[model samples]
Target: MSTQIITAKWIVTGTSRDGDIQMLDDAAIAFDDGVILAVGPRAQVITAYPDAKVTPHPLHLIMPGLINAHHHVGLTPLQLGAPDSPLELWFAARLAIRKVDPYLDTLYSAFEMISSGVTTVQHIQGWAMGDLEAVVGSASSVMDAYADIGMRASYSYGVREQNRFVYEDDAAFCDRLPPETAKKMAAHLHRLTMPFNDFLTLFDRLTDTKTSPRARVQLAPANLHWMSDDGLLALQEKSVAAGVPMHMHLLETAYQKEYAARRTGTTAVRHLEKLGLLGPHMTLGHGVWMTEEDIEICAGTGTCICHNCSSNLRLRSGTLPLMPLLDRGMTVGMGIDEAGINDDRDMLQELRMVLNLHRVPGMDPAEVPSAGDVLRMATEHGARTTPFGPRIGRLDPGCRMDAVVLDYDSATYPYQDTDIAPMVALIHRAKSKDVHSVLIEGDVVYHDGRFTRVDRDAVLARIAEALAKPRDADELNRHALREAVFPTVRAFYDGYLQTTADRDPFYKGSSRH
Candidate 1:
């Protein structure tokens, strides 16, 4: 637990009222015992921690580790061939061709995320009914990736009853299902829900893993909208009983809101509130179509909203009122959503997009979020959406030594003002290559384009092998019905695909969704 010095030309703390966005020069961060011990002038810190190790990262920016509030990490490889279909159709088709190996995808995704200085990701993992042993048989490689690469992560598997014929088919779209298929799916879920060994084993095994001082685990209830009323309520209760956070997709789009309202005689968010599922322990993804009242209710209940900005833009799911949400006292953070559709898991890109997306429609863009706001979303706010909220995010004293050093020489070039330096440089230009090094819990997981403790090529190869395999009959059935229903999904969404593929600027380029 010896101390260390991380001196940088620019120190962007992203904390409230932390002077200008950037330090004048030679800013130093000192940490020991897996926690930051001081933050001030380089000369002062050097004098104090003289016996501690000194790793000067000058000509770069040192800041808190980036957090991804929502991302489906294990799908990194299979995202290559994802059809640009509507929401439900796209998900169904994608599921059919999912890579059988969750470990590889998780590894590759973690490596990519780490290279970009994403020290933590709240990753969503989907598994089929019968793939218990395969889906997440051992979270070792993934947890290993985090430990060795010095990143933190959250993982979840679920009891998602995706009735294939539920969307579109030959008059078989009702709740009724044939005996065999239904029975098999049910039995698979039974086993999947009960296997706590892999998660438990990984957590226990990786207690001494490389660089993971802030790592943690939690139960994720995939989607409340997709689950049955009984199932959804049961998951909420279970999460509450286990003292874990309940994460799910809620009011993601107009269609979802419409469907839920039709079924429960109320809006989706309202329905959850009435069911007692909305609370401090709940974190909902998307929240794109939430009404003002719904927003107020969430704030009052202390619920966290994960705004998946990139995914919503790509899926044509409409825009979220981020300003209003923040103004109303809601604890909001950003998520990368599912991998692939505008799908670069780079949280820096997510922050850049968030800043530009809010510009005035036809006025000067000077009023948009200053770079400080964007940085906060990725660092401070992102951490608030998970279990490590208190201990990570900021670089203040007593926080974990999880940090990233950005090379101002490459992706960042020619700094103008020393005052607004970090904001102007980072928000405008932050490439994955700009990351010089990443540290998790005072251990260097990545440095100068390579991981310190893992075989990068082997991980990529394993993910490729898993995705190269084919889907069996049951998985194929799920894919076919969902893809076939693409033509009937609220027509406008069909037009959305045509417009995107055609790159048509006119809103009416296609006549559907």
Candidate 2:
């Protein structure tokens, strides 16, 4: 590979020194053979490598490419004209959408992510259509799309053995449905269900055959409510044997808290501890309802949590106790989680939102999220949760050459101070349109409003053609079944909560949990 130097007006190295973001003003970065060679003063770099080709961005800010710690393929629910609902009901509505080709669906979101400065995404798959062969094929399509687009991705299929929908015996809920609706629901479940062991086997097979430097396959148990004890234990064992990272959604709602209390006689975090599932390798998604004790356990176990701030607010899952989580020294990362405040995969804007959302009415300067903290969470902390190895997110020497360049000349100047830190100003004001270029593995995948590897317009057109028929027979059937079963599912939870309201601490919301 040819050696190259990129001189930028500012380079936010995405590393901290003495609790501050390390910045190099008027610096140049050199890369060769998909690895960073140097990052320092432009004059020194020029003197050091006189023969290297130079690409100068006199009015730009270069930084490590953002990592979206949690994401899913396909269109956003808001785009489908579906309003936000609680996660339990939202799952049913989300399943009512038409299925498109996995490759196109993955590309559709990748385009959004790359354009918005996201270089790596943890793409969690929940689709289990047809047999094992078909499922594996769909997963391969996702991997192929990311590979072709030159985006780094970590992939996992969401798996559960029981309680596919509500937090109870799905069969018992089916018994309340009319025979026809019950049969339709059962068929739908069968279409989307695979044995838990088969999921583990599929993970092994995918990793063995579809290996790539940019793509990783890992284990994910959907959530605490969805998986049985045996299935969770089996997943833990498999994850340990494979030595890959695990991701799961935990306590994203009050309903989940109630369910955990009733089923395990404790909180979800404690239950996972009892199952021996909380550890450095496991990353819990959302974590919106963790109590003080739960936080203590997570902190003790060295578990990481990916905070999806906009997703929680949009779905009314309540705000994650981010300040508390940070205070407890638990590792935290940022994820768009299928949608952000703008209902798109815009990581820069997502960083801004995270900074603004966690401010707790205090006069102390340290009470709110600093720009460096939020940016690190999006870059470094997010990368730590993926299977991308150690040197993935930072922009230092020997790290993978993944970066984003924003045009500081356009909407990013005048007030950007050299004496004072520029991260705070950039985080609050930067927009996705300001992204001028994106590179992964020393390759310029997106530059000057175009993707180097794929035809963006062509893939988008194909996606539109693929999803032209909005509602298929299967989706229509699932909708009818959801309509019949969701009421009972809602009522069961309401009654359970009502009966246990006085006894259960989870029912009381303002308890600093």
Candidate 1: tens digits of C-alpha lDDT, residues 1-513: 778888988776665632235443678889987789998888998999889778787778888888888877555424645665546656534544553454556667777778877887886655533333444445544555555555677655544543332222222332133565445434433543434344333333433342454556665655554466776776676666656676787767666665666567767788888888888788888888777788888999989888888788777776777766665656677777765244567777777888777664545433445566667767777777887876888888898888898887776465556564665667678878888999887778889888887889877777677557777675566566445443444442343322113221212223456
Write down the TM-score for model 1: 0.82
**Estimated TM-score for each candidate:** 0.82, 0.94
lDDT of 1: 0.67
Give the Cα error of residue 377 in candidate 1, in Å: 1.5
Q: RMSD for all candidates, in order, please.
A: 5.9, 2.8
Q: What does candidate 2's lDDT look like per residue over 12-93, in tens digits? A: 8885622368889999999998899999999999888899999999988899999999998668876764668877778766
Clashing pairs in 2: none
Model 1 residue 173 CA deviation (Å) reads: 2.4
- Stretches off by above 4 angstroms in model 1 are 17-25, 77-80, 131-145, 158-214, 340-342, 362-367, 414-420, 465-513
